[model samples]
Target chain A: METINYQNFRIEAENICVDYNGKVALYDANLRLKPGQICGLVGMNGAGKTTFFNALTGFVNISKGKIRINGESLRSAQKDQTIAYVPQNEGIDSQFPISVWDVVMMGRYGSMNIFRCPRESDVQAVKDAIERVDLTDHLSTPIGNLSGGQRKRTFLARAIAQRASILLLDEPFSGVDIRTEKLISELFIQFKKEGKTILLSTHDMIHVREFCDLVLLINKTVVAYGETSEVFTPENITTTFGGISPDFLFGPES
Target chain B: MELFSFLNLDTFITDPLTHDFMRKALLMSSLVAAVCGFLSSYLTLKGWALMGDAVSHSVMPGVVVAYALGLPFSLGAFIFGVGSVALIGFIKQKSRVKEDTVIGLVFTGFFALGIVLVSKIKSNIDLHSILFGSPLGISLSDVKQTIFISLLVVILLSIFRKDLMLYCFDPRHAKTVGINVFFLHYLLLTCLSLAAVVGLQSVGIILVVAMLITPGATAYLLTDKFDNMTVISVLSAIISSLIGIYVSFWLDLETGGSIVLAQTFIFLFAFLFAPRYGIFKLQKLFAGYK
Candidate 1:
């Protein structure tokens, strides 16, 4: 494979392959995301979207691939806090005795001292992130007391506070309210304006069409990827979803 | 009126301190309880109550080995406690068996080995003292050992409280931001082992798990903040230790059993009467709706 100029892209994955105990989860997956692009990762269930995200964050070892974030190795990029990840909502212990402010403050933990005592700048960043998510009223509330949408916003706030150049979100819209959806959409537009790279996985075709400028379809590997207008065709959707053109895609494209 | 005479202020509070052994037991138990209370918050929050039980029981073989080698009992107990944790993790990862099953298997095996060693050996290692504790007969050396271990555990836990909290609460997030999850995992296990060794001196192997669980569980029901939970847990545990020591002295009861009973009673009280999360409060709130 030819070596691409890593400086031109915020995230670069070349022939990424992941194997879980000899079972192939992702194979020969390749993607290059430039700054200021919102790439929608569209795939079916068990299609390795989460696996790809895990690979990017260095959570899972890549069996055969080179991944560079902002022209550096994944570990160096993570150390520099170049990427922020908002994982799906299922794994978090909501009943944990933590406030929304504390959860958001976790975003700044990398910048804090060994004791994690927040500096003035860290506190200000946490406040700004919470404000961006419009969760100021519930800042001090225990995370368990929040509604589902509020809980999603709290994690989003943590990601926003990270102030990283690249953002990776896994199904950020699942099970959230309409108000939260609108709020998140607005944030995405603002994030793009700020020239931050974003890669989000979602099942909602409407959200893909409306918000994503670039679309990458995958079924264990990259099926197609390009500008949304060109790549997000019915054929691509059908191929990605294993031969079924989802009903949502047939809806009038706005 | 005569039934309440045991509660006389001087006889209950002042009499026990006069005896050198009673004073040492009181001080050692309180120190052990305070450290256990502090760790309980993390243990309960991480859902490691069973893990605590496993580590405590696993230390028995180490204690016996240390005795046979003429070594410090805490050293042997600490090694086995940490070893069992690592062994459990290894087995759980290398095989398909669930974590709880692995923990149960490994701890019981180590405990049974300790029992077998006790029967086979001819040393002065009193099985009763090791199992039920010898708080009433605590030596000065035991007092110093408990103080040193408690201070060490308390200092490390205080310094890393927030980092440990983040690790326990959202380890995935902790990893994404560059926190060393593996190091923190082992660090917590090591601290738990240290806490278990300290607990062994006061509550013995059988009841140390209670010292490491009930106070934290009670405080968890009482608060919505980790900081507050630690404080409440420490206070409750210390109070229980002091009260149990006093009552045991006056009533001629087993000291370790009495302390654990005091902890259990407090936990029950919190379960029924905690301001927001209490069972009765939730019941009352539901009744209002009906």
Candidate 2:
């Protein structure tokens, strides 16, 4: 497999807003992510975290403001394969007949030349990704037959196979078991060591403190974003959660 | 003895090939079935069965207009087929009307206009052929035309099969991988139109929709893997087309209706008896899940 040149990938968003049929879903959402850092996006339900991710990934049209990746606009960055995203609660249709290997192979489709089949390197990368996610035994199993945790790992493996410098995950740990979360954390640590940038959303504040180097508290807009130690305070938590954080604890015990 | 002669398998299979019209009908319908089966795999997977019906019916006006202008039927069919989809998209996006309602409105309106025009034109063209197929009337030129269009559909679909499968399976993932999902959407739509036009030659509008749906549906009940489903779909179509043509010859029935009946029979068999997904097995499957 050819070596992927891991450069200093950075994403900068300014005053991003998204409107869904006249209803505002996000407003003035701004954040900057530097390479080799893990940022946790903390937000309440319906707080536009997924919408923000969608805007950043160019999946949804940004009604206002601009986002740049590695100093290039989101559109251009997307064209160059600088970012990859894993959506939350991805319930693949039960009748879909693709295997785990094929799902992971799709990550290489973007980089492959038109009319050309997947090269040896592409196959190698896919194999390594599957093995990394501990899904080597289930390589031939139909994706729809996999358990929830297995499915999430399959998608994460796809992102790994994509070889993108920047990764955006929406609620990566939602509904997954503790073992799967631990496996993912280890993988993220390994990715950070290799200089890959990651931004993920989660409600697990304890995991956020343990794994995320930076935190972005959001509720329909940017509330606070900085190093985790400075930004993940009780006051920021209350503000981000719309005053619902009074019952919550600030320390790891909560 | 005479009443039971229709059950004679030897004559049933051999008699159809004796007449030139019957031979042409068999060849034309087989080609149509092959193409439709290939397309139906994706159509059923994506739940575009209704969309197939919409495009098939909506092409009626285009067919009539093509005849009036001396243009190719496929051209008119393709135009109107794509136009209906665009109209549906427009209404669904611009207004609060749901997609199914928009589809129902656009296709029926186009079909009604076609009926009015056909009634007013006073042409010698048989309206029955346009609505319900006239396989026995297929000429050498029609054979050439059908083969050309079917070949194009086959080649393009084969080359882009993987991409199209991924597109149908998970469009969001396809988009994330930098695929032009809009292009894939229209490409699939265009394929549906082409298949409809091609099937229009042998099965007409109503039966074309059947050919676009039943073969793949039957195959779906047979396999869990899509690649297997596609192969099974094409095979089922060819087998049913041959048997339908032969049975129609034996029974002196309408060719297109017989073909659809044969397809329906196969679907029923698969529905009741398939190993993994049949109604019988579904009981056991659900019990296991419980």
Candidate 3:
């Protein structure tokens, strides 16, 4: 619970710099995460947490620095199928045409080669993931029709189905209802317990502090880093929001 | 109706293509219509249909350049069209310029360059067909190109169907899943260019771009589901093609423009009258007007 072997890390970003156009989003951002850990990245808007995520998943071109997964750089981990990224956009409309089974099958695409389609075992993994998410009843329903919580569960199921050692989630908690958020946080913990390394970018300080092992305070630079309890202070929260109350962080009721 | 006897419906539908031109035109337009329907719905959903207009018209310079160089005109047009999408994409990311503004700049610039080239080369070239297509101008070579490219677009798209849809609906999420967002972006652009080029030879740029947009726009009025939108758009396109050809024949008008005109009619009707989703219907409900 206290520490992970730095040598067995699943993801490591060293002196990463990301820019959109000429405007740099992240500068000299360094992060490390071992398997069996959940690392929460917290920041204000334009804080570079998402940009750091963008670097890790190969979304934005690597402007500067290196990202490694499972002890290999993105190039090698990408080749080895040791990682999966859970995009915040994975939510579906209530009327989305695809079934639960089909949506989950997307996970296998990264694992499968271009020449080969998903195998039967791949489909079974999707079904198992759906069942794990407790979406068995709605497996055949269109994903677009699911509730917000269900949609979040569907994406969680997808990441689970990927069965990768590393999971990178971007703003997964935003737009999700509270019950689903709790369930998702627990699942991240479960993924960590199962030795999967999770690097999630979120604005919710309380959850990150409660659930994450280590925290990276990002704002175009590494504002702070280390244990969640140490990284999240009242001043840090106030500074990150730039005087805006952390209402979204605490919950809507607050 | 007795009108069928006077009109020779059997001769038109059953033995419709005694003339090679008619045969090629019908075959080509039908294929073009189907492909346009599929591509349009996806493009519309992703807000890329606007870019479709920009790129298709912007492809003018490429076509003119290719013709000037004596290379395949469509190839130049396609490369430029896809290039424009990539360019716009990067520009959107890199600059603070509004998207519509970028589209307008690129669209007008490329189209102006094309106009200049065509004017310079007007003595030797045929700009009429590229601007306003001759479905009847479809050759056996053109037919092969249309079929091959359309098939390629559909196959590539279908193979990566979910990926394409994911990218379209929410690229913010697509990047999270380890999917190459830019790769997929350009992939769709490439497919769009292929569709445009193939449709150009079979129909022409105006009708090709229209076909790639209107059917999907009309279908959006009918359903919210992505798959349903695709199916509805394709069906609408096929219907428009069949009816447009007949109407043109009956009126002794140009077939390609007639088909586009017919599709526009469909769009208008759908826009006004689609149940629950139509603008007119929504207005009626809102104001409690009959």
In model 1, the fraction of reference contacts reproduced equals 0.62
Kindly report, for each predicted structure in the order presented, the TM-score of its chain A compared with the true chain A.
0.94, 0.91, 0.86
What order do you get sorting by TM-score, best first? 1, 2, 3
True contacts kept of each: 0.62, 0.40, 0.25
Instruction: DockQ for every model, please.
Output: 0.66, 0.51, 0.25
Query: Candidate 2 on B150-241: residue-level lDDT in tens?
Result: 99999889888988988888776667667778888998999999899989877788778999999999998887678899999999998898
A101-130 per-residue lDDT for model 1 (tens digits): 999999999778899998999999999999
Residue B211 displacement in candidate 1 (angstroms): 1.8
- lDDT (Cα atoms) of all candidates against the true structure: 0.89, 0.86, 0.75
Task: Spell out the clash pairs found in candidate 3.
Answer: A93-A144, A93-A145, A94-A144, A94-A145, A95-A144, A95-A145, A96-A144
What TM-score does candidate 3 reach?
Answer: 0.84
Regions more than 4 Å wrong, model 2: A1-9, A246-254, B282-290
Specify the CAPRI tier of model 2. medium
lDDT of 1 at B228: 95
Record all residue pairs in model 1 with backbone atoms less than 3 Å apart, i.e. clashing.
none
What's each prediction's clash count?
Answer: 0, 0, 7
